[model samples]
Target: MFYAHNFSYKTASKSLPGAPDLDEEDSLEDAVVVFFHVEAGDEDNRKGCIQKFVKNTKWLCGKFATKSVLLHSFNHLSGSKSSPEFARGVLDEAVERLERAGYTVKTTPFGYFNEFSIHVAGDSLAKVFKEF
Candidate 1:
């Protein structure tokens, strides 16, 4: 995940024309763009991913007084990515948990390539990388 000084996103086009949009053009300050990549290995450990994500989010929020998160699908982190369906499941679960934790969660729709701009923070914890 990358901490952002400012972040914004826009739904350019649907990955599938009939697919529903999950987000709209919006901007946020003091937020984190969670590029949640679902690796092939994550298919078998979905629960672990949800737990780790929540734990990491708690840490980030407390450390930075962050209240907003943008969940973006980014499969480039690893050579192997989970199936699209599996990834969606994981993403849905993460959103649910994060929202329950009182975070303002915004999600880019699954199965779509979106447009976004982010000004990454320069602080020590501005960018974080974790694998589960």
Candidate 2:
């Protein structure tokens, strides 16, 4: 799994689940908004992926001084993406772990394309990329 995150003052995303009328907007403030791409090879060891995800997320949060996170499934970062089911599992586990750590976490619905907008803080540590 790979993640590209930005510390944003505000962010918003609308689900593009293919039904025009079904679009729903989700927004957050003072959050580390993460765009995650699950690679096809990461399905081999789910537990390891989850651990790495948590560690990397912790680092990101500490470095950016944010306690909130928004997870967005984004396969565009990699060419060898995992299946939707597998990707969802990783993302769900990550959310669970973060929540247990007492961070406010929100996730856009899985299995849907989304359109997002974010206002980044432009700090050097505000943008981070991690591979897990």
Best by lDDT: 1
Residue 55 error for model 1, in Å? Answer: 1.1
Tens digits of lDDT, candidate 2, 39-84: 9989898889889887887777787677788887887557898887
Instruction: Quote the lDDT for 19 in model 1.
Output: 65
TM-score list, all predictions: 0.86, 0.79
Clashes of each: 0, 0
Per-residue lDDT for 63-94 in model 1, tens only?
78888888888864568988877888888888
RMSD of each: 2.3, 4.3
lDDT, candidates in the order shown: 0.80, 0.71
Model 1, residue 28: what's the lDDT?
Answer: 84
Badly placed stretches (over 4 Å) of model 1 are 13-18, 21-23, 76-78
